[model samples]
Target: MSKIYQLVLHALGIASFSYSFSILHSLSKGESFFFSIHVISFLKNWFMVIAVPLEGLISILYWGILIYDEKLLFDKPRLPILIDLGFHLIPAICLWTDFLFFTKEFRKSHSHIFYLLLFAFSYAVWIQFYFIKFGTWPYPLLSKLESQQRVGFYFACFALCTGIYHMGAFVHTIFNKSLPVPTKQKDKAL
Candidate 1:
């Protein structure tokens, strides 16, 4: 049951990423992709509201395991969990930096990055799946690049995201961490 749940979670992550990527790619190329069926439309709607946020939450959990060496999720030296952590953390950082520093509205709302990262992360997963099943990468750069280079790219992305996460975490820690506690009397009066 645990294994099945893990597989479903991973599949959900992949599907959310793929759908976002397809939408972004189509938009970038000035094309339209439509969903005619209700199920497809429902999934797409939920991708933005639910799946993307879940991805960010998973990324934070990954970072907690990797950076803080938390043991709650898995035993130590679990290579697959480590690898999966790497996968989510890299793009999570990328999207955060792109939003916080590069874009206007996104700086105020970091959650926007969740959706953006989903697009890139999904593409990476799809490329990996292609490599695994057909033994060839769909993208020319990924296909032709040396194994070391590809590994480096993945790590580099992780490092970049770690930096951004720290920065964002710092900002939130300092500026946004505290909130006013409501009084019980005031609450009751309201």
Candidate 2:
């Protein structure tokens, strides 16, 4: 049962990652210019949003089970959850803070942080290579910004991912701890 559950969760994760990457790629290509017309329309009309969030919820559920078993989730023998939480929380904070205060509003969700980090970092590196090769960054933010600013933007993205991850972990911990334990079965006289 656990294996089946893990398989399903992993499959969902992969699907979500792929869907998100397609959207990001589309944005980079200027295929979708307007924010609402792009993301909202895609999410509302397609399977990305629902599949991605559902995948994340399943992943979190698995993590919660692990944490419940040991009262910790990060390292073997139960390292502080905070350490793992930091991994997710930092990125999430950076991404949101940078965009919200500096750049345009980008929808930040805890569900997409892991995949976003993976996609963004790889995509950013690829964009850098493209810029080196053809003198053009794929995305507007990267194209318009100075090198230092772009690097900072990447770091901010990392922080945002970490923030969202930690938030999810913390919430899972709280919920897991608060759940009612099942009553023990009383053995009757044979």
Candidate 3:
């Protein structure tokens, strides 16, 4: 993958996570802000929905491919252990935690899946265009595959990512149900 492209996506996920965290912190401290609560909530939720699956896909695909074939992912000077983990693991974990715990449950809809497909399609276009210009795919594995196989690979990724997104939502539901969460209670007369 292009370093710049990877950086941009990572930066986006990190920025969204930071923004969501700050908003949560402010709410905890009872701080007033410029934006309405609803607007803030909407934006944060949308951001999480997009970022969580993206980061999840990155981590999932990276580790999966690494295990399957290391040469496909890295060159002679491999990334340091910490740097590799930082890039491929931490963001997914952090974003998944934030999405599952901090945010309210999002309404599950077919539209969400559509959005994911749209993202996948957009990325496919970018990567293919890059390959056309550069005369090589970004990842060694991609270059090795036949064109039909590449399409199948992309479909598999889309399926896996969609599963990851739904799995988080499912787990979130279970955790919220089984745990004792704090809520405001009315005072009774003494």
Candidate 4:
């Protein structure tokens, strides 16, 4: 189970949880002196660009596989209901909520596509290396796939993640547009 942290899903979940906690703590104190503004901004952008779409992908793929063929992901022992939801569902909801409602930094741009592609490719290499070193895949799905099939799977997932990112950006645009902007009230001049 120690190797579980190397799984992309677990890694992204950890990132999502950490980001949520960091944002909450920063908001509570009204200042983040620990990190410089540039570092904070970079981290925020990285999280929004890479982590958000990846989490969405993880959520969708995980639930889809779990529903379609549970045996593919697990053999006998199953995660508890809450633990499963915590791992597979809540990170997505939290990240998407933060992306849609609280964040305005995401915009439709080519750089986002680059970021997604970069992350997808990097993860593919990392997982391949892990498989080479460990004699077992992180997921049974990969173990069943041949080399070419795994490449295709990774490409398909990258495309899916790109689509998800664009969809989130589109929703963000429409949501922000529909929201009424706040206006300050003027005192009565008597």
Candidate 5:
């Protein structure tokens, strides 16, 4: 169950990463400087980008023992052998590599969970849009769930997102503890 959940999260991450990269690249190359504002704005400010990396952390921390019974790669021969690696493995590797080697301190706030939930909520809105357009839910879980149940599912996932954010913040703190967190204002004389 959680394997499928992570697979969905991974797909969302890939899509978000693609869109963000495309918009930024278009700007850098002067290809669509004026046309990608909406996309660029969302990628720059929205929490959509973090969903997968957070899930990736969850995968790494507890790949099979805690999250689910199945492994990330399906036991049955399904799709190409490496497709699972691309979707399930590489993204997590990239996320951890970037965090361990490149990310800056205090680059994110612990309070960013609200922003993350906002992004998830926005995705929920899109899920509704997709269902209306296609007359089917975007994912199997949503499809299996009734209207209110779907809402409950999303709320539970939002709570999960909140927890993921705190975990990410903790990891970031551990990785960056040596560096002083910058303050907007210094302490004054007392």
Candidate 6:
């Protein structure tokens, strides 16, 4: 997919989610429907919620496919292979295609790294909250690991997100050399 297409998809996805939440907020309060900036800002963390998916995809591929025992995956609830692919593998493929193909227009600047980190940190907080509330780890890999190990896993996730952002920016700069940067210019002298 082209970078512009990916960016449009991401932006549309965010707007759609924000709209859905805003409608829910207004409806819950018996107010007329409107997209509110105050509400969106209040719920800003909900935007660009891609890092969690990235985390899941990365952790599963690294732990489940790369290092874990085969039987662990084969055994148990016996989820169909297609289901796993749908949830995990397919998104990774899409993310890669979005980053790798026709992406000269999508150069992530250094400031963008913070966006990835924000999501990663927010996700870690959410996971910690969920674990505390449920007394269960959401994933088998985390559940099996010790507390120290789990912290290491979270650290690795942060590192992975950071590396991805940096690498994306570097690739953008390198691959997009021939592409002209769009800039806003003043009107001609009147």
Q: On residues 15-87, what C-alpha lDDT tens digit does candidate 1 reach at each position?
A: 4463564355334432234543343434444343333334455576456645764443443334476556455
Writing each residue's lDDT as its tens digit, candidate 6 over 141-176 gives: 666778888778787877766776566556556755
How much RMSD separates candidate 5 from the native structure? Answer: 8.5
- The segments of candidate 1 whose C-alpha lies over 4 angstroms from its true place after superposition are 1-45, 80-82, 91-190
Residues 4-47 of candidate 5 have per-residue lDDT tens digits of 44445656565457445434634564435755555554454343
Model 5 ranges off by over 4 Å: 1-77, 107-111, 179-190
Write the residue-wise lDDT of candidate 4 on 12-99 in tens digits: 6655664764485355443456666556655776677787788889889989998999877775566888978877778788888877
lDDT of 3 by residue, 1-190 (tens): 5543464465456546655644764475333666666666777776666678878888877888888888887554567788777777887787777777766646566777888798788777877997888787777788789989988988888898799889877887875665667998999989
Q: Candidate 1, which ten residues in sequence have the lowest lDDT sum?
A: 99-108
Clashes of each: 0, 21, 0, 0, 0, 0
Off by over 4 Å in 6: 1-67, 70-75, 173-175, 179-190
- Candidate 5 overall Cα lDDT vs. reference? 0.57
Alpha-carbon shift of residue 138 in model 1 (angstroms) = 33
As a TM-score, model 4 comes out at 0.82
Which segments of model 4 are wrong by more than 4 Å? 2-9, 17-32, 36-39, 178-190
Q: Which candidate leads the pack in TM-score?
A: 4
Structural similarity to truth (TM-score) of each candidate: 0.33, 0.35, 0.80, 0.82, 0.58, 0.55
Clashing pairs in 4: none
TM-score of 1: 0.33
TM-score: the better of candidates 1 and 5 = 5
Question: Judged by lDDT, which candidate is best?
Answer: 4
lDDT of 2 by residue, 1-190 (tens): 2323333444445454535544453456454455544654444323332333333443454355565653322222533567535433333343333222332222445556655566558746865776787664443345557889888877665665465445544544444454577999999999
